[model samples]
Target chain A: MTMTATTDRTLPDPADRRAAAHAFIAGQARWRWPEAVFWLVAAASLVIFPHSLVLAAQVLIAGLFALSLDLILGLGGIVSLGHAAFFGLGAYTAGLLAAHGWNEPLTGLVAAGLVAGLVGFATSFIVVRLKGIALLMVTMGVALLLHEVAQKAHAITGGDDGLQGISMAPILGLFSFDLYGRTAFIYTLAVVFACFLVARRLYNSPFGLALKGMRENGRRVPAIGGSIRRHSALIYTIAAVMAGIAGGLLAQTTEFVSVEVLGFQRSAEVLIMLVLGGAGLLYGGFVGAAVFLVARQILSGIDQTYWFFWLGLMLVLVVLFARNGLLGGAKALLARWRRA
Target chain B: MLLSLANILFNGVAYGMLLFLIAVGLSVTMGLMGFANLAHGAFAMLGGYVTATLMAKAGWPFFATLPAAFVLVALASLVLERALYRRLYRAGELDQVLLTIGVVFMAVAGATFVWGPSQAPIRVPAYLTGTVAIGPFDWGVYRLFLIAMGALVTLALIVGLERTRFGAMIRAAVDNPRMATGLGINVDRVFSITFMLGSGLAGLGGALGVNLIGLDPSFPIKYLVYFLIVVAVGGLGSIKGSLIAAIVLGVCDVAGKYYLPDTGAFIIYVIMVSLLLWRPLGLFGRR
Candidate 1:
């Protein structure tokens, strides 16, 4: 009698829960109009702003880099100070490939992603255990170590002078890179869009929800049958692969790689971009990259020597006034306006 | 071979002392207060610039510049603490990091504007220059001075923190802020003073460093990793741990470079990872 009663009550719960989960995932994955607008704007930029394709290509690369960071930062709530380690590795991977005569662009990217992913998998074990200041220092230490290694292996990495004479094969043997940057822009946009699709899908999945659950409450995640370390480490490695591809894109587009690619400043700059655009939001990376690149271009134009002053001021003001960053703040305002 | 080993040992100790001096203050604030104050390096940079400007522009001797660096950076820290950092004491880690990074950027630009982008040269008095013969080996006079200064500062800090009534109050506040307040201690004032004191020490370290590391706009970022490493390995809020940690790291780093020649930089980082994995709280940190 007791077993029958328990079965009657609990049987519907699992089915109901599963259905609810499916509905939630579907709702999140459902195509939003703004996402369409976003792609439309990107496509139109190729035509509307053809002269600025080079900058647009750079912007897309930065966006992709930031997006990769968001995978860990937004979902896992893991703050990494050494993301540039992967970026630089990817760049070097692509650079070396081209330098050694395997200049095919598409294959070069795959190799870059694989190499970075391998390193990420190795380091993720160490990264997943630490938190707060310890996490920050360790990540910084890892990057600095890589930076040191690269400098010492100058014979292979070009040392202080940076790798020279890197050129890439045309896209699918059809579109060659031109000085006007049309090929670069289209190529970069296509790659970033594909990555975005993956990120969007992953963010709406049950696995991503589990990672988010751990971020909200680590203890609760365990109770819900999730392994905190495994989720964190896997997400970290995935992000590293994405970051690697971004770096590869940069190397291919620029046709060069410098020792500065793996620098502490580069890591800090990317983190700043992510936070400035409101980290944790899927589209925040794109907005942050656009703002940062534009700001960099405009500020440098105003005065090369003191542009940093204005950027610093902007950062301070943003932190003080808008704690959640530009996108978060804007969304809050929209919410408030609608209620009123 | 023996002479070279000794030489390496001496150089390593000197470098380690400099690292200790630069990081000890950060160790205290970060360890005890639980603040991620990365801009501590900026204060150190300010101190270096101050020393450089005084020596270059006004022709002050090295000794005179040191005190000025300490007092000035301390005052500047006080201003920043009161106006900016005070608001973020309870904020998230990201807020603290971004705010400090902003400060570093501003400081770098400010230094560049005032001092230009070149490395600022420092001239130590002749007495602090040249080598002195000690037991069949010539030891660098400047390096010997650095060791002496490092030891003196350590002794002073140890005595000040362990013996003084102010130290007790500071310790109490860090241990239990609410309880310290209930005990009639002004916790705010204590933290402010401690923070200023830490900044002043960093400034002193920076002024002292000018002769060794040289002063530049990139000073903060250039040595940021080394400082952070010392604190991380040393354990927060423990002077003895920092001393031991700094000495070990300094020796390893210098010796690795000397022997390995090519892959010298790899050793210290390896040591750090191994140590932290074994003991995440560092050499003396509490849970």
Candidate 2:
């Protein structure tokens, strides 16, 4: 036993090194069984209800939008009521590009993301300094400013009538956007999946951990040698890019854009959707968007006049009872059930 | 150009008075309670609707309906504070925002259901209508009345908050709730009364502002940003600050709308953003 111990101390075990490497990779990937199941369900839904692809695509786009908000509000501890600024900026950029003859989907999407990211980067210096209501005001102010600009710049934005004649080219120069929205759904799903993978990787990264730390105690982060401002600005820019991509997807799919994209109501609705699904968790955005859109569809169909009343009541109740949101509530129930 | 400038100044001051009336309560509640109530405008809308309905349907005079509007909206706000807002005193700002926004949505929908989603027509008394020549300028009697009311209310608020025994209790409660409670002050009662006063003032402002700002189902959402700007720029709890900020905003808005009609609200927003960036704590706010 002494000889074995001496040998172990003198020479590092190859098996132990292999196990450590495997553990590092696993930590990096962090893919759970449930995540795989979620992807499977998403794919199965696409196949099961081909006719509802348009609605599904919209839900996915909203999910991406909400996800972008979640990164700032949930993970980075930055509450913004104007994430629609990025989304609207992206939509207008893509819409204008398509209208002016750069109709290629991928190129437009990239341009949209880059433009939104640049704006976010520029504004983050101002935005990240404020907390609580001040932050909310500045973000809302930015969006309101953008909305006004869009409304006045009628030559490019089409004013209140909306940007028309945005004809998108085929995906990969092969599959065309169809009337039934089959290609749109597949294209959106692919983008969402790609973005989700990147987000998942980000959430598990060292930078992400630092953000979580900042959220909990911002002062402590700097004490621990983390650059809170840089991380926050970077995350804000990334989230903006994601939101831009979502907006670009929406514009491309619908082939139109409007001033309403930058409206306060849209920003409020996205915030509501993010809170409804859950925040903090990466999948919360997707779940919230799905639930909110579906619920809205059903509620409006039932009684258009009183749909807002119900929505309002639901929001109040959610804030009162389920502060952590629906996904968090569901997770708690599951945990309790397992313990039982 | 001189006449136009004078006209702008008069109109701006009148509009600013209306904003001060609406936003002073918001500033007080936010500073004292540390609660971000986005539904303050909803109460103002309620007051406006009530006054309009009473004037139109019940054949009440505009002056008579103002008191009724104040009392009714104050009572409504009281019930809401006791039942809902009281529970959320310790909740996070986000939750407060969500709850208040929900209230706003409900209020807007309710207003739409009752008022038919159109602007409620407000008819001022014959005496209050039309322009009266004063010195080199002709001012609307209603605008003059608004300015007078605004001045009286500001004086009353300053006296009440700074001089009265109840005001002392309120100040104590706001500065140190636990200490106030320990010293035998009924903090809850003070809070409730303060809330009622704020809401009552908001209602009065709404009734007064119907002609200038318009009254409709979308009134709350339409003027929410304006009210917030006033409160933010005025330094949350300072009535004097709100008064100044509201007047400045009113002037800027009136001037911007007249001079740069094509640009819409672009200039006002630029001013607000720049002001906020420059003085995040507000012009008169203390750390």
Q: What is the C-alpha lDDT of each candidate?
A: 0.89, 0.90
lDDT of 2 by residue, B188-283 (tens): 899889999999999999999998889988888999999988987778788888999999999999998999888988887787788888888677
Task: Provide the RMSD of all predictions against the true structure, rounded to 1 decimal.
Answer: 2.0, 3.6
Model 2 CA deviation exceeding 4 Å by range = A1-29
lDDT of 2 at B42: 94
Q: In model 1, what are the clashing residue pairs, if there are any?
A: none
lDDT of 1 by residue, A1-340 (tens): 9999999887777779899889989998899898899889987889999999999999889999999999999888998888999999999999999999999999999999999999999999999999887788788778878988999999999977989889988999999999999998999999999999999888999999998899889899999789999999999999999999999999999998987889888898888888889888888888888999999998899886577887677778878998778899999999999999
Q: In candidate 1, what are the lDDT values of residues B1-287, reduced to their tens digit? A: 99999999999999899889888988988876788888889889989889988988999988999999999999999999898889998987778888888888888899999888999888889999999998989999999999999999999998898899998998898889999999999999999999998899899999998888788998887788778788888888888888888888788888998899888667888788777877788899875
Q: Candidate 2 docking category?
A: medium
* Per-chain TM-score, chain A, candidate 1: 0.96
| Separate DockQ for every predicted complex | 0.66, 0.68
Model 2 lDDT at residue A111: 91
